[model samples]
Target chain A: MDLAPPIRFELRRGAVTAIPLAIAVGLFGVSFGVLSASTGGMGALPAIVMSATTFAGSAQFAAASVLAGGGGPVTAILAALLLNARYLPIGVSVARFMLGGRVARFVQSQLVVDESWAIASRGGGEFDPHRLVGAGVVLWCAWVAGTVIGVLGGEALGDPAALGLDAAFPALFLALLVPQLGGRRARAAAALGAGIAVVLVPFTPAGVPIIAAAGAAVIGLVRR
Target chain B: MSESWAIVLAVGAGTMAIKAAGPVLLGSRPLPAQVQRVVALLAPALLAALVATAALASGQQLVIDARLLGLAAAAVALALRAPVLLVGAIAAAAAAVARLAGLG
Candidate 1:
């Protein structure tokens, strides 16, 4: 099938749909950049490069916090790796939509961040590859741009907390989640997941709680 | 400094590998039915988990603070079917005002 026009439409829709998320992600990136500059021993180039390459905010934040606290490099990297392990399942879930040849698959896989994944998965069973890629590109650009701005204006940006941008991340996620809670099963799964995460927050490492919460989806599978 | 750089490089490489693992291993094969159902549910589950943690916790402990109020405002905005950007803006504004009022 000729997938061009549909892909194009989805791409445009995805980019437009992602603007808010891109903005929130940009703010988060700015916070990371400022923190990296101040305490992570990361200069502007390294900070930009990390944001561009890793493109994962929580992992970057974890690594930066560890480094700032004088933790060893190995320890920081390990923490980041553990935090990022959640991507493995996300990648698997999105793999089918990563259409095309080996090269295309490899290239598209790099765009698999949380926002893109969430947007792409919202298509109810029909995963849209174009939407995923389009959202990924916009988010990547926003994140990189935000990091550059933050690094250059590190001191001027001050603490993102003061501006209350720290709340933006959760706000965006909650917004995305509300629309998905339409069905009883979905609501149950989400409630279970939230409960698991809240209970584990004080016990587990930072990212582990979320990954563990992903297990709550088994309720959906069991009910099916 | 070099150690920091090395750590960054290692993390970059490690994260890339993790991101690539699913596509590399799973390929284009359709997931099994039960797995597919679970995968379908993963987004809502993981996202809710993230929201709970992000809004309520700071470091190791859960805090009742401006962030909670901001989240509540954002929830109201979302329930009203406001645009995603507006929801985030409302949340941020609510938190900022609450903080200014020494709420947190």
Candidate 2:
């Protein structure tokens, strides 16, 4: 369907799609910032830094959980790394776009996540790099803003877990997941990657599973 | 603020490395078409992996508890294509209620 829809269509769809997902991601991130702040011993600064760079909610949450629970830096880092290893494949998968500008490519990979990638891909073929960048920019701003909100919101709640606000994070992931299951390969690959990731949790470090599963899947993908 | 410098550096460095690692690692050769195809699914796989670990595990053991209850509730919400905000709230509420009820 090379129907080159007006760039306007791509722009509109990209913005619309990116906004809600960004908000969802922002809600999750804000909860994380608040949770990190709630630890009493940690600073809001550290949490924000984690969110800005890591930008990975689950691993960041896991890292914060471990850190707050008195885990060592090594433990926290390992947890975060293992959990975030998924990004490696995400980076590789999207690397094709990074070809033109090495620097931009690097930056792009860093920010790619469930929200941005999904939104960008949906822009259809009409969705050019510009729209993708626009979507990412929107999501990034929203996430950071939401983090502040979540930080303040968490404090006001005093215990976000009390109101079950914590669940919003996972719920956000759920919303992103349905739209992503676009094909059999994707669904099967995801199932395999996740199953491997879950089973390997106890043995592997936090970030290793996604990388491992992606590695495993790559072999299959390449073989076929 | 001083501590934030190191944290900021770390964040910046981390992003720089992960972003750079791809091209540096892959060089010029395109990934096999199959692998490129599979790469598309990494998001969901990662999502499921994270979701399961978060909701289904307690410490080192697998336990069916409030978290699981919440996740299950959220799954229903997802199936129904409920809005994200409502889904998250209901899931968490379900988990909290289950915890309160001792049924988890």
Candidate 3:
């Protein structure tokens, strides 16, 4: 079905606003592509296919790293799923805004990523679904395109970490976090979450630290 | 299918299910007031955790490496109110320079 003019305008504006972040994410996609193709036991086709289908960066990287370390399929899949556990809460947060039939809602849900979600957020628990969908589309395209380039380039891409693309994830996350640090409760949660993650990093599995940190948000339950 | 294909398809399927679970299950239900408050704080908490893990840890170990330089540079850029893209670029450049200087 066709989008209404107002929604279409919002979508376009979202796409435009997301372009810069998309470029950064695309470069990170290139790193994933190279890693999967080179040592993750996934060839060019499967790597690209995974990127297109899964559309989750940290989870994909975790799975590929597991495989690269000679872990089995079950291990890789589990690691990826654990890394993605955050999506459950993320989905809940935005569910009401996701209007449409089941099929459309599912399709829109596919577009939700950390970057797009952050971009779509209006403080105080609000969101713009059109912006989320729009940004997701652009970022998805860039991710897949970057994967194609990386997998095809393969060995020639050398060490992606050397290019500092790995740094982009943290950088991007920091930028996203700063904007949301507006209130005392938010700041407290942020500090608690970061502390939990930092302390757990040395003791937990790949995805555990991040997941454990989400518990810090339970502080929101206390009256300010 | 090859093991790689199997893993890829399985992970894809699993992640799709995970992503869809919320919108599918909740389906426009009105969340409780407390739940809404928690949801509002979720993004900041998650993003902060992401920053900590992505910048400071590699695997199960905390590695104080060049990624820290990148993150610090990003902090400075963000403080100066740089756009997100420039913040990322500044970060990558800082990490790359650190690596070139034999830091990581």
Candidate 4:
């Protein structure tokens, strides 16, 4: 973890936008918490702790589906691995900026996410790994907070939950995704993954098949 | 212990391992620039792919639906280089209206 003194100074100077970012992350977390319940999550404790520790919202959602459906460990692991393979690149990209030793890089790796990637990739400035740790911790907490509410308060959703409120996530993720569209290969791969997932959803578990489709698309890209 | 937690634990462990690979492997050696550029684009590309997967669904053997409509609307907005937020709202609105009209 990044030390308190310097990261605190950075926070005081307003170089970090932890609060807004955490709230934004909180929305996603709430949805996932509701999702955990919808997917038959164990209890608030397990659900919240899962969100806090894993810190990958999509993977957590996907995992919920897998566990709900009585999927095997291999299926869960493979699905999580595929869903999170995107992080491999995030790790590599952030690796470019670290001036610290092995321990620092290791910690920074766990904290890498959409916001951290944005912060790190914006430029090579004075934002240290400490700040990144602080942001990750906040983001993780926001997600956990949302999970707690979602699990405990989930029964309150009633009709909205029944009406497929989970669709909101795919919609939200899609919105976050549209702007970055570029190049033929990338377009092709995206199309392939979506196509396969849509086609395969009925035959397989809800989120699992989609992730499998993503793996297939990634393989195709790797080959190309 | 929820089964979901099991999956999360597995993912957390997997993510940490993937995150540690490059830095630990290189050990103070700067990576090739070409590799860096490629790595930079990987997350965005995968995000786009996952986004597309999230948006569309296949019903009764690839019938057209609101998702396709939303996708097309999103495409037009995108071609005009609309802001990301606007494009998403426009496309989603178009799709939602169509679905609400019982067209999905």
Candidate 1, residues A1-224, lDDT tens digits: the string is 46678788999888888889999999888888888888655666788899989988899888888888888888788888888888988898888878877778877888989888878765444467888988999999999999888888889867788798988778999988887786777888899999999999899877888889989888866744
Model 3 C-alpha lDDT per residue in residues B1-104, reported as the tens digit of each score: 39989988898998999999999888999799999999999999999999999999989999999899999999999999999899988998999999999998
Which 10 consecutive positions of candidate 1 chain B have the poorest summed lDDT? B1-10
Best-fitting candidate, scored by lDDT = 3
In order of appearance, the predictions have TM-scores of: 0.96, 0.78, 0.97, 0.67
Pairs of residues clashing in candidate 3: none
DockQ of 1: 0.78
Error in Å for residue A16 of model 1: 0.8
Backbone clash pairs for candidate 4 read none
Point out where model 1 deviates above 4 Å. Answer: A1-3, A123-125
Arranged by lDDT with the best first, the candidates are 3, 1, 2, 4
Candidate 1 Cα RMSD (Å): 1.8
What's the distance in Å from true for residue A85, model 2? 2.7
Q: Which 10 residues in a row give candidate 3 chain A its minimum summed lDDT?
A: A34-43
Over the stretch A1-224, how does candidate 3's per-residue lDDT look in tens digits? 69899899878877987898899888878888888878546778899999999999889989888888988889999999999999999999999999888898999999999999998998888989999998999999999999999888877768868888889879989988887999999999999999999999888889989898889889989986
lDDT value, residue B2 of candidate 2:
50
The superposed Cα distance between candidate 3 and the true structure at residue B98, in angstroms, equals 1.5
Worst 10 residues of 2 chain A by lDDT: A122-131
Q: Compose the digit string of candidate 4's lDDT tens values, residues A91-167.
A: 65566556578887777677776655543343221234555666676766787888887877776755432232333
